[model samples]
Target: MTVALMWEARAVEGRGADLLAWVRQQPLADEPLRRDVLRAPQDRVLVITWWDAPYDADLPELPEPDAELVTRAVHRWRFEALPEH
Candidate 1:
C-alpha cells in the first residue's frame, strides 16, 4: 500500500509568499511518488506527498520553517491508500 503525508501551515500576516518559497526550497530525504502544493485564501499552505510505504512506516518529513514565517505550529497527517474494490 502507499501512504500519503499531508503537511499544512499558515503564514504570518503578509508572509505567505515567504512561507511558500521556503517550502518550495525544501529537500526531501526520500523522493515521493508524487507531490502537490496548495494554497488557501487565509494564507494557508498545504504540501501533500505520496510515498510507496505503509501508513505506519517511518518516513522523512519536511522540517518546520522558521517560526517567524508561520503563525502557528505546523500540522501533519498520514493516510494509506485503500485497495480498489
Candidate 2:
C-alpha cells in the first residue's frame, strides 16, 4: 500500500518566504518515497510526502512551525492511494 501525507500551514502577514524556508530546513526522521513542497496565495504552504506503508502505519511527518511564524495551527491529512485505472 501507499500513503500520502499532507501538511499545510499559513504564515503570518508577509512572512511567507520565511515560513517556506523554515519548512524546507526541517528534516523527517525517515525519508519518503517522494516529497513535494508547494505554496499558494494567502501565504499558505503545503507539503506532500508519499510512503510505502499501510494506511494506518505510523509515518514521520513535518512538525509545526513556531507560533509566532504562522497565523494559526497547521492542517494535516493522510490518504491511501488507489489503483490507477
Candidate 3:
C-alpha cells in the first residue's frame, strides 16, 4: 500500500521566502519514496511525502516550525492511495 502525508502551514506576513527555505532545509529521519514542496499565495507552504506502508503504519512527518515563523499551527493529513481508474 501507498500512503501520502501532507503538511501545510502559513507563514507570518511577508515571510514566505523564509518559510519556504526553512521547509526545504528540514530532514526526515527516514527518506520517503517521494517528496514535494510547494507554495501558494498568502505565504502558504505545502509538503507532500509518499511512503510505502500500511495506512495505519507509523510514518515520519514534518514537525512544526518555530512559533515565530508561522501565523498559526500547521495542518496535516494522511491518505491512502487508490488504484487508477
Q: Give the runs in model 2 whose Cα sits over 4 Å from its true position.
A: none
* Residue-level lDDT tens digits of model 3 in 23-83: 9999999999999999999999999999999999899889999999999999999999999
Model 1 agreement with the true structure over 19-51: per-residue lDDT tens digits = 898999999988999989999977899999999
lDDT per residue as tens, model 2, 8-84: 99999999999999999999999999999999999999999999999999999999899999999999999999999
The collision pairs in model 1 are none
Query: Comparing candidate 1 with candidate 3, which one achieves the higher lDDT?
Result: 3
Ranking of predictions according to lDDT = 2, 3, 1
Compared with the true structure, all predictions reach lDDT values of 0.92, 0.97, 0.97
User: Per-prediction count of colliding residue pairs?
Assistant: 0, 0, 0
lDDT of 3: 0.97
Q: Could you tell me how far off, in angstroms, the CA of residue 26 lies in candidate 3 after the best superposition?
A: 0.5
**What are the models' TM-scores?**
0.94, 0.98, 0.98
Error of 3 at 10 (Å): 0.1
